[model samples]
Target: MSGPAIEVDDLHKRYGDLQAVAGVSFTVERGEFFGILGPNGAGKTTTLEMVEGLREPDSGSVRLLGESPWPRNPRLLPRMGVQLQASAFFEKLSAREQLQTFGALYGVPARRVDEMLELVGLSDKASTREDRLSGGQRQRLSIACSLVHDPELVFFDEPTAALDPQARRNLWDVLREVQARGTTVVYTTHYLDEAEILCDRVAIMDAGTVLALDTPAALVRGLQADTRVALPAGLLSASDARALPGVGRVQDGDGELVMSTQEPARLVQALAERDRLDGVSVRTATLEDVFLHLTGREYRA
Candidate 1:
């Protein structure tokens, strides 16, 4: 396989006495949509900032497309785009003007501005001032500004933090378009559902370290030891269900019998034999489950 488009090796960052990112390591292959997830103060922002060259790591290293991410290499700055957690634009500047100004900074042609506006579905708002646009529109504009120079890799920091459902979906589509164009993306978000839907692979970080890193499916399946099987209320009693093959625990709840097992197929078949399975629901597990198991905290907590 080719070397990763973005690579971090034992990255460490600090703020005075506090260790913000501690020996975290991961890689994003070229053209892949990678996600980083964590709660507040989990060092996610610090890690991303280091990779984006907005901040320096106290130790270890980060490379973007095979070069150091820090020291702001002039030749490399144009090949990368970034959407900060809090985007600030000149309030009086029109969307078109903002894009043109940013384009000039990267020596990008003015035509690229129109292309970016269209790419983010903001072409109709080109004449709108930054302060006059709605939150969602401004967010779209921020994304468009990042791509004005057509960077090969883009870093998105909580890109959908405050958007409505439709706006968020629009952003997702835009990101999909970016990926289809073969741009590698490093996305950090608090939304696990967004990560599940958008990322090819994800790294779950907390307390300055990665707790798990894998494709969403694989990560969820890794929690199979606690598989949950939900069947209709009258289907089976807790005691009878526990005696089934591979079922280690069973609980009655909310008009269903919840069974936990490492081998769901065996338990499922056992339950099926007695005509005790109805409205059966089997889930492979999820990032939320992994997060809960690993940190002893809920995914949203």
Candidate 2:
């Protein structure tokens, strides 16, 4: 509470010969909506578990709310909440019943349970059994259970992993509202678009190390990645596209001409001057571009 809500230093975790997390360190400011992004098996879950006190690191240290998370600190338990990537619920329990059960575990009052169910927009389905709820509803119930105690800091691991597009957006709105109320949130996901839209700052991780950490806009801009221009195949020869003002790289693939440029307006003007603007469209670089730049195109586990 006085310093960073979460602090990790020289963290290392090894599973036999496989090093899941290696010498990682970072700080999460109080009340900041932070994101940890990486592909599967990038040690994201391992790192988070260590911070949440769910797993002890082989080496290094973690402090949650200024107290050590290892050895199962009881004081931190009351001040923190976590929603795992996958959660199992008692199928026979109603939405309201489930939250009440979790609330009792933390000595939360019955009023708090009701508040949480309504906060996650599950009020109308409060009586529905867990097994009868939709996937999105179950997810919301998971979130509601995590917050039933009103913990100051919350952690979510891939909270929207398998949700439909509409459900994802709806949950996003719920998260935004949570941030508005001043609770610090740490979220992890491989979804670049979600991190870009939801997090105030993101740490990009790969191979058990953080490759980059900053605001999504700053990270993407720091790469100096070019704005991409796409055109129909044969709209202009590859040579002509490459020769265009401000263009940097030209790639011809699948009957389309794609090129990168720093100056989209200038390139557009030049193409228009040549009467070659048809089928041309420009797109700005995104966090996905930054991720690929840092981690390379190779697939990871």
Candidate 3:
């Protein structure tokens, strides 16, 4: 309790010739919402699995709640909950039944099942069979099952993958509620925006290594990536935009024109004078920009 909720030191994993996690290390503070972010095959899941005691690391150490996880420690499992990337459920089982079953395994009270269902917004569909629930509803049930025992630490791997925008937003609220109740959450997702808004701190992983770990704002600020200017496409030629003072990079983002500039005020004034400020908007670098800068690739692919 005095130390970090989770501590990983020089963790490594290998699958034959493939090295999944390579000497990764980080700490999650007590009750903090920590996120692991990366593109596909970045070893985020492998690292999380090692820390969760679900898989053995090739070398190094992991301490969850201040105890070793690799040796299959009994004390660690009950105090920690996990929602894997994919969960299996009996097609015929009701959502409530599924939670009740998991609760019984954890020796948790049946009342806890109802509480979890309500917490994850599944009470209305509590009686719906697993096969009958929508993707979002099923995902909520998966989350409810993980929290049925009220573990001190929870690990979620891509909890919002494949969800629609609205469902994803709703799940974000559920995760916020979970954190509000004082549960330390270790989450992994490909969604950089989700990581930006949800995580207290994030570790960006790639090629079996942790590229950077820090608060979202700190990471973006570290880049010193200039302010972003957005406006309708074709407002200015790429060459002319680059010719502007303090402008660093000009990108055609979809149909909108985006440019990075250090002197936002000057850029705004210039655009206004040129009648190019009709739909212009100025903002700071986002987590997505930072991720792209660090990895030299898009977060999605």
Q: Write down the TM-score of every candidate.
A: 0.87, 0.91, 0.89
Give residue 212's error in model 2 in angstroms. Answer: 1.4
Query: Could you arrange the candidates by TM-score from highest to lowest?
Result: 2, 3, 1
Colliding pairs, model 2: none
Model 3 CA deviation exceeding 4 Å by range = 233-259, 269-276, 298-301
Alpha-carbon shift of residue 232 in model 2 (angstroms): 4.4
lDDT of 1 by residue, 1-301 (tens): 3678898999999888999999999999999999998777788888988888889888999888888978977767888899987999976899999999999987888789999999988889899889999888888899888888888899999889888998899889998999999889999887788889999999988899999999998988787657788888887778888788888778898788888888888987887787766689996677877766776674444
Q: Superposing all C-alpha atoms, what RMSD in Å does each candidate have to the true structure?
A: 2.8, 2.2, 2.9
Put down candidate 3 lDDT per residue, 1-301, tens digits, no spaces. Answer: 5889998999999999999999999999999999988888889888888888889988999888889987788988789888977999866899999999989988989889889989999898988899999999989999998889999999998899999999999999999999999999999888999999999999998899999999999999898878989888877888888887778889976888888888898888888888888878888889988888877765454
Error at 97, model 1, angstroms: 2.9
Question: What local lDDT does model 2 show for residue 171?
Answer: 94
What's model 2's overall lDDT? 0.90
lDDT of each: 0.87, 0.90, 0.89
Candidate 3 RMSD to the correct structure: 2.9
> Regarding lDDT, does 1 or 3 come out ahead?
3
TM-score, predicted candidate 1 vs. hidden true structure: 0.87
Tell me the spans in candidate 2 whose CA falls farther than 4 Å from its real position. Answer: 232-243, 251-256, 269-280
Q: Which candidate is the best by TM-score?
A: 2
Better model by lDDT, 1 or 2? Answer: 2
